[model samples]
Target chain A: MKLIGYFRSGASYRVRIALNVKGIKVEHAFRHLRKGEQKSDDYLKINPQGLVPSLLLDDGTVLTQSIAIMEWLDETHPQPPLLPKDPVNRAKVRAFALAVSCDIHPVQNLGPLNKLAAFGIDQANVTRWAKEVNFDGLQACEALIAAEKGPFCFGDTPTMADICLVPQLVNARRFGADISGFKRILEAEAACLKLPAFADAVPEKQPDAE
Target chain B: MKLIGYFRSGASYRVRIALNVKGIKVEHAFRHLRKGEQKSDDYLKINPQGLVPSLLLDDGTVLTQSIAIMEWLDETHPQPPLLPKDPVNRAKVRAFALAVSCDIHPVQNLGPLNKLAAFGIDQANVTRWAKEVNFDGLQACEALIAAEKGPFCFGDTPTMADICLVPQLVNARRFGADISGFKRILEAEAACLKLPAFADAVPEKQPDAE
Candidate 1:
């Protein structure tokens, strides 16, 4: 398998963390997101949306959407499952992941941020917008983990929720958001960072690390 | 099962069509979004995120996120599968779905519109933003379907791709987008409209239909 991605992309970060967890290393291709490389013809051929973290299969099929790719990973490689076995628990896990990916991340993406910049919005305003929405997502997710006692977001097993949460939290911290209210998640993040898979896969460690 | 949603919510509309396709008659608990009812403590107890299309199970397990709910519906009711059997095809179908739900719909959501309003953006600017993004999504989706030779988004069947497509098309129209570039999707919407299941689930036809 091959993964095409930008190093600092939260969506790509999710994929890297998942791949590391699965112990599957791929031929990594870096697209320089800051240089407008995602919109290049070659990259657009890989993902028509010109988005990062498009997984190219050995047989040459490409997968987009970090959650969808993560689900495919869970389905095909089950030894260390990203989702829980129980359906209800699985729903909770999936809901948490989707809440991050769907409700939070998209609105604050680089594309939209660039659009904001196009309107003569200052860098501070752009950062503030991203931080504001992402902080809201983190808070909502923190509330979700409230019910389920966790070393991770769902339980201690490091399901898909953990894969999603770590990157989002990383994003929040990077943007200077106040993450003080989410105590349990802070604990979970510390635990997640201790693992070699996660630690080594941090965006700064990637070949294309910006 | 009970679904908490407004009739005109495109996200909720997707789940409603999925449930109808599976012949699952869950109770519909209306949350008048226009009236700010989703912000209530009762709804937040079920879904702290305060997003609509929250599905409450008989055992009291509530699921949020339209994609998660749709997948749960597919898993629980397997007769007419929303996803295809092949991994490649399934990835293709799901990418098509996320192109709207993840990338497009969230940006044009009511909250973001309200945010733009607060940013001193005029109604014309909000409408312009919504139409542009929604239409960009439609054209991308149209390319996906056109490549796959679709009566629906994938084939003749109304997969999750179509479930996402039709609702966003409705939003696009509501925002006065010029969807003329998406000839194939308009065709798909017409096809989706013909299904007794899809027809009955249309937002305007629902109990709280605006």
Candidate 2:
């Protein structure tokens, strides 16, 4: 398997943590997103959305969408399961992941932020836009996970929710979003950082980190 | 079972189609999004994200996120399966769904569009922003499903991909996007509309539609 990704992409970061936690080794390929490499014809053929973190299987099948790829990985490799056994619990975990993936990340993504520039949003204000968006969603995420017993998002062990949360928190901080009020999230992030899977998948630790 | 949603929300529309297709008779509850009912204290207790299309199970377990709720419904009721049995195909269907859910819808959602006002975009430009974003995504979705044997998005059957596609196309047309070039998509939409599941889930057909 091979993974094509950019170092700073939170979606790619989610997959990297999942691969490490599942102990699945795949070759790495870089798409320097800031340089517009991902939109090139070669990469577009691999992922028509021109997004990062597409997983290429040995069978030549390519999987886009980080959540789908992570779910595929969990299904194909059962150990260190990313989802719980019960259906409802699985839905809860997925909802948590989607809260970040759908509500937070996509709105604050580089594509949308760049689009804001066309609306005459200057650089500093663009960062503010990203941070404010991240803040609102992460607050909801904090409340969602508050009732769960967690060293991670759901329990003592990390699941897909934690995999998604860690990277998103990293992104929130990068944009100068004040996360001090999200105690449960901070606790979960600290617990996840204790694991090599989470720690090693940090953006600065990736091979293509600028 | 019950579902809480607004009439015209694309995410809500996806779950309604799934319930109808699966033959599950869940009670319906409407939250008038334009009136800010979804963010009511009562509703937020059920869903921290306060997004529509939350499924309330008989066990009183609330399921949020349209895809997660649909997957749970599919898992609990296997008849007329929404996804294929093969992992690769399932991933394919999911990727198609996320191409719209993650890439297009959230960025153009009311929350983000309202935020654009703070960035000094007027109502006409806001509509233009939403339409342009929808156009770009639907075009990619058109290319992604082009190779498939699709009266629906995948094969002849209306899998999760079609479930997502139909509503997104509805939204695109509402936003005045020129979707004439997406031949395959229009064909799939026509095929899906022939089914009562798809036809009945249209925005105008909903009980809460204005």
Candidate 3:
């Protein structure tokens, strides 16, 4: 398998953590997102969305979307499962993950941020936009997991929720989003970072890091 | 089971389709998103994300995120499956679904659009932002499924991909996106609308729709 990603992409960072958690090894490839390499024709052929963290199976099938790729890994390599066994619990874990991947990350990521800049919203407001979106989403995430007895997001082990939360927290810090009030989320993050799987998947540790 | 949703919310519409597909009957409730009802204290207790399409199970478990709720529904009631039996095919279907739910819908939805308006981007430009994001996303969605001989996104049946696409196409038309060129997507949309499951989930048909 060959995993195509960029070091700084939160989505790519997500798949890297999943791979590490499952102890799966694969060839690594990079797309320089800053240079718009993901939009190149060749990359588009592999992933029509031209997004990072596409997993290319040995049979030549390419899986796009970090959430889907992570689920696929969990299904194919079931040991150290990234989700809970019960149906409702699994739903809870997935809901937390999507809150980050869909609601929070999309608005704060490069595409929308750059679009905000293009609208003559100055750098200060653009930065503010990122921070506000991150802070709002992370607050909701904190509430979502408020009831769980978690060193992780759900339980003792890090589920997909932690896999997702860790990366978005990294982005939160990057945008200077004031996440200090999110005590539960910060606790989950601290717990996840203790493991090598999550630690090793940090953006700075990736081969493509600048 | 009771489903709390707003009629016009695309995410809410998604879970409705899944319920209709699986033949699961549930009590229905609404949170008027435009009136800021989703943010009301009571609603937030059910869903901290303050998003529509929250499913409240009989035992009082609140399942948030349309994708997770749909997956949970599928898992608990497997007949008339919303995903393929094979893992690879399941991943492809989910990837396509997330392409809409995460990438296209979030950026164009009420939250981001209202934020852009708050940035002093005029309504006309804000509308343009919606159109551009929707068109770009739908184009990628078309290309993503270009290889499959699909009436639905994956096969003869409407998978989660088709469930996601139907509502998004509604938003696209609302934004006046030039979707006339997406032949495959239009074809899939046509196929999906032929089924009552998809047809019944339309925004206008919902009880709470203005």
lDDT for each of the candidates? 0.86, 0.91, 0.92
lDDT tens digits, residues B84-104, model 2?
Answer: 988888898899998889999
Evaluated on chain B only, what are the TM-scores of all the candidate structures, in order? 0.97, 0.98, 0.98
Score candidate 2 by lDDT: 0.91
lDDT of 1 by residue, A1-210 (tens): 999988888899999989988999899998888889998987777787888899999988889988889888877877688888877778888889889888888888888888767655689888888889888888888888887877888777788888888888877887888999899788788888988878987888989775
Candidate closer to the true structure by DockQ (higher is better), 1 or 3:
3
Clashing pairs in 1: none
- What is the C-alpha RMSD, rounded to one decimal, of candidate 2? 0.9
In order, what DockQ does each candidate have?
Answer: 0.69, 0.82, 0.91
TM-score, predicted candidate 2 vs. hidden true structure: 0.98
- Candidate 3 lDDT by residue in tens digits, B1-210: 999998889999999999999988899999898899998999888889888988988888889999999889888999999999899999999999999999999999998898999988999999999998999999999999988887888878889999999999989999999999988898899999999988887889888888
Candidate 2's displacement at residue A56, Å, is 0.9
Model 1 misplacement above 4 A: none
